[model samples]
Target chain A: MAEQVLLLDFWPDPSGVRIRVALREKGVEYEYREEDFQNKSPLLLKMNPVHEQTPVLIHKGKPVSESLIIVQYIDEVWPHKSPLLPTDPYEQANARFWADYIDKKVHYFGRSVWETTGEAQESAKKELIHCFRTLKGELGDKTYFGGDRFGLVDVWLIPFYGWFYTLETFAANFSIAEECPKLVTWAQRCMERESVSKSLPDQHKLYDYILEHETGQNQPHL
Target chain B: MAEQVLLLDFWPDPSGVRIRVALREKGVEYEYREEDFQNKSPLLLKMNPVHEQTPVLIHKGKPVSESLIIVQYIDEVWPHKSPLLPTDPYEQANARFWADYIDKKVHYFGRSVWETTGEAQESAKKELIHCFRTLKGELGDKTYFGGDRFGLVDVWLIPFYGWFYTLETFAANFSIAEECPKLVTWAQRCMERESVSKSLPDQHKLYDYILEHETGQNQPHL
Candidate 1:
């Protein structure tokens, strides 16, 4: 089979990182092309016309939008090494459930926390803490989200661990790890994997980038 | 194989309807058990401990939460009749993409429209219209979202059509067919199916229920 070029319209996005991690874990070789939202490449627009958002992966000239969907596509296309999802239908659905849960609840709650102020921020923070605690309880004895193996859910969420720490520092009102020790430990275990560790950016650097942008010192990384 | 007793913890939710539609479409017989959020059943709580929300499907003792996940699970488990998804990997991922897009974007924007007031309401309405227009463009010349057949994405989103006329009546701000004629047509085509027609309740009834609940009536249906 000819090698497919994977064009990723990404910008340090945790969602995009999931696909990158999956590709890296699977050892799938593909060409990468970065996209700037302010000046979006025509290819990106052509690929995902509806959302016109980032993290669009162009595989064999066909564009796959949505991070989780792209990750699943990559998994299917390259199923030889380091399978991202479970083989069993039930287990696969369970993995997808957790992944979707994180995407909807945790991801949205995190954004709500960052995008608001005062009462709204307080409310979002409360929701975030609740989400983290629930996830911690679920992660109780498992080394990874998908039991002993690092599977789809783990890859989808591990990138957010760095961002969570950034939020804890910048917000200065909450500590995700302190609130959910098991989640913190689980995150640490995920980061221990070379694929995850190598793919993730520095937490403090991300914090500085966010702070600079908010303070008008840095431009939007679109 | 033994007849699987599907224990569904559902309420009058559009998300739950996704699974209900899938079950009906596949001609799968399953038991339905409605859940009360105010006083959740132990089974519901145990099934989905993290979210503690409805639309939980307990099939052969294993519980599946998340509406889309349950829909896919049902499709995988029972593939003899009308298939909910495409067999081709790319096509399956594309179907999943649109189904998820509707769940995230359309559903979120619709909730914003419902929960806001004044300027916020107007903004949400505009957003909803934009989403509808985009969807309409995507569905241009296609009978269903799955291109010739009524597949996963169609089943996942068609139930919301029941709310469109009601939203137009109460909100008195937007017109579904007027704004997105193609989408309206596609929705109409979907509703024409016996499976879809039989599974959903009347639009006016749902509207009245919403109005009653909003005004503190809290009736049984509401």
Candidate 2:
């Protein structure tokens, strides 16, 4: 039987990109079903009834929700090439920990920078810079977050690099490169991969979407 | 060289209990250090600089933070016995999804039940019941969350059972056992295990601690 792998995804989602990058790395041929956030597909809702959110990976009709989990699933099921996680348990745990850190810390602060304005945006920028600095410290001159290899953290966070342009331009707080030069270096390093570069939407396009929503323009594209 | 595994934990923490249970399941003997939340030990801070949270497991001077991550690490490093996670990638993802659900949904609702008051408390109760119903529906007639053998979900959730008494008695909103009999039965089965029973602190004592804190009584223990 031919392997049927389907991804219910949204373009702007960093979470969705994690799975996309993983699938690409694994060279898995799968169908992509775009989800309309305004009117989420019934298939997506049914596939992920608990969250009713997208970036759901359906393998052989069995759905796996949560992007990081989906990425791990893909890596495990198709363990031939471009491994997302380290083989050693300790290293795997470290990678999982950082991916979660990105989810909990980076994802929220990154959103707050765009969603809020004035003092709140400034605070968000400070928090974001601090988080990036911490991430940079962890990266510490390494080629990627998992060191040398473009693995879990690279896949999880590289998508957010597209938002940096908008975040710096829109918020006018600080340049990501200035605040966390090493992290920006890491992001650029990740972009060298065809998988990382192709999986993410264009940065300017994402910026325009953010600008439209911020200015109360009708986001027909969004 | 002799092996060294140290756990920095606080009693009454469901997350901490997860590591303890996993450790016991593996039958690995190690030193346990209780962290004072008000004044966390220097060792705890140094070990888990990223999170500065406990249930940090130090194996031969290397630290693993985050409760669930630590739990998985324990399972991986000690793969010979009492495997906590399923070997299959799909099942592993399923277990991870539910654990994340418990963290995002159950963790919040479970805390809000006792932490808030009046209308907020009422809303929390409603949400908590809804979460349990979903969990119950997931559990159905399974002996354990992972079917016959206890697995990740059971380990992740059973710690919260100790809080059930405190939540029901103190909040006076609902009885967990009454709402989710199957879950309660599952919890009872888990408590029968020596690993689980030894890891969790007594329920009523935990309730009194909650009462004291809520009533503005001096919490020497806390």
The candidate maximizing DockQ is 2
**Per-residue accuracy of model 1 over A1-222 as CA lDDT, tens digit each:** 156757564646788778778878988776777877558788778888877777887777888888888888888888888888898889989889888888878888786666677888888889988888877766778888778778898897888887886677646578886788788888888888888887787888877766666445234331
lDDT of 2 by residue, A33-123 (tens): 8987768788988899998887899999999998888888888899888878999988999998998899899888988888888999999
Question: How is the predicted docking of candidate 2 categorized under the CAPRI scheme?
Answer: high
lDDT of each: 0.78, 0.85
Kindly provide the TM-score of model 2 when superposed on the true structure, using C-alpha atoms.
0.94
TM-score of chain A, all candidates: 0.89, 0.92
Candidate 2 segments exceeding 4 Å error: A214-222, B214-222
Model 1 residue A129 CA deviation (Å) reads: 5.0
* Candidate 2, B56-130: lDDT as tens digits: 989989999998889989888888888889998999999999999998888888778777889999899899889
Per-residue lDDT, model 2, residue B213, is 67
How do the residues B159-216 of candidate 1 rate in per-residue lDDT, one tens digit apiece?
7887786667655557878888888888888888888887776888777766666445
**For residue B174, what is the lDDT in candidate 2?**
82
Q: List where candidate 1 sits over 4 angstroms from the true fold.
A: A108-130, A171-182, A214-222, B7-11, B109-127, B173-175, B214-222
